[model samples]
Target: MTFKPLLAAALLATTAIAAPAFAGTKMKTEMSATPTSNIVETAVSVDALSTLVAAVQAADLAGALSADGPFTVFAPTNDAFGALPAGTVDTLLKPENKGTLSNILTSHVVAGSYDAASIIALAKANDGKAKLTTLSGAELKAYVKDGKVYVKDENGGKATVATADVQTSNGVVHVVTSVLLPK
Candidate 1:
């Protein structure tokens, strides 16, 4: 089978195993004051994003994410990482798995800073869904459902934006309820 199908299956399977039901609430990510740190630093500052921080470090993407070009990161929380099958994170963290880990991590990062409003508007303009290209060369569908913003992986697995428009010096961060896998 091709990697696209595999990625979709993996995402759906992982989500099915542990994702909690999202409360049907409107998306309300407020635009907070700009933070002085970059993406790495910003993510590190969040207690819930520790796993994502570790993965970024393990993937050796700290420097790139710290660079000048603004990026939009859909960061998964510790709980999201924990939702994966047992041993999944451990295996991905292995030194030999650096490439794979990097791909997975970069899949959550887009090239430019796309805030909540832009995403929502983009979706509304494009038939209720916007295709966002990630740094890993994957396409994620951004849409609004039940007044909440959600991102759908190529294979149809979805992640809710738990928080949005967290401004960092170099880019923006959106906390997501599940890890997004690339096709």
Candidate 2:
């Protein structure tokens, strides 16, 4: 029962007991360190983009989007799909209309990475409208209305960027209020 041996044992026991609490804090930090999802995964996670996700799958565009892409997508919400004329979305979903659906979806996609600030600057340079050539070979005009960016399609259909610059692993998504139709 020497004092030195007793003190050494006490120190060892204290360290061993305190290690678990520090380890528990480390585990909590690790749990929160989980990375963010990519664009397609982000779309799936959002409740508003369900229809857009379905259309992407139906058009066979999911794989391309999910893969490496610094793509800028003007993602339309489910309410945007619902805003179409009666039976429009159902008709587009038909197998025979896959080509048309593909075209429509592609028109909403641009080749490069365009965040809201850069797009706004481009618009400012080009007379308040930035002409973006889409993946479908169609042109989309980005303009600012009431200080918010809006992308206009060929048919005079306008989709407001209701939510701007949602950063993803591959690219950015500007959630639009309306579906953009190809001319």
Candidate 3:
């Protein structure tokens, strides 16, 4: 009855509830928000981000993320996690790797609300790239390539925004195609 077992079960159940999130699959997300939409809520509502919702629970970040505050989360789709090496996600979800898992998850978050337009403006102002300090204290850079927005982690990981400008009450969720790991 440990947290990890429960976490895995919950994730499995969610995957069953939502449409399978696969890589390179064009995902359509809600662009408008109601008063109830938040980062975690928006993610859960999306069929492409079921894995992300599960990780937030496993990392014990659901409460914190659901709190009142501006948090811009660069969420990775299920396909993004699937793109990782075999067993990488499984290993990270283990109880022993909670700290690492938390750090990795936080690496995708930034304090304060930043919409896609602002991010693009910042990137434009910064001469095509804007370096962002993540909630995990790691640095990720945002840049536009081929008319699409992308964020690069310190560890050379890059995640492209599959869907942008998903408004939420707490902040915004930009669905990305890869999991940006911590440095």
| lDDT score of residue 70 within candidate 1 | 91
Residue 5 in model 3: shift from native, Å?
Answer: 23
What does candidate 1's lDDT look like per residue over 78-176, in tens digits?
A: 999999899999999999999999998888999988887778778879998988999989899988777677899877878888877667789887788
Task: Rate residue 179 of model 1 by lDDT.
Answer: 87
User: All candidates' TM-scores?
Assistant: 0.82, 0.79, 0.82
Clashing pairs in 1: none
Better of 1 and 2 by lDDT: 1
Give the poorly placed runs of model 2, Cα more than 4 Å off.
1-36
Q: Rate the local accuracy (lDDT) of all candidates.
A: 0.75, 0.72, 0.75
| Model 3 stretches with alpha carbons more than 4 Å out | 1-27, 30-32
Once superposed on the true structure, which residue ranges of model 1 sit more than 4 Å away at CA?
1-34
Q: Which residue pairs clash in candidate 3?
A: none
**Candidate 2 lDDT over residue span 65-152, tens digit each:** 8668888998998999999999999999888999999999999999778876688779879998999999999899988665556789
Worst 10 residues of 3 by lDDT: 14-23
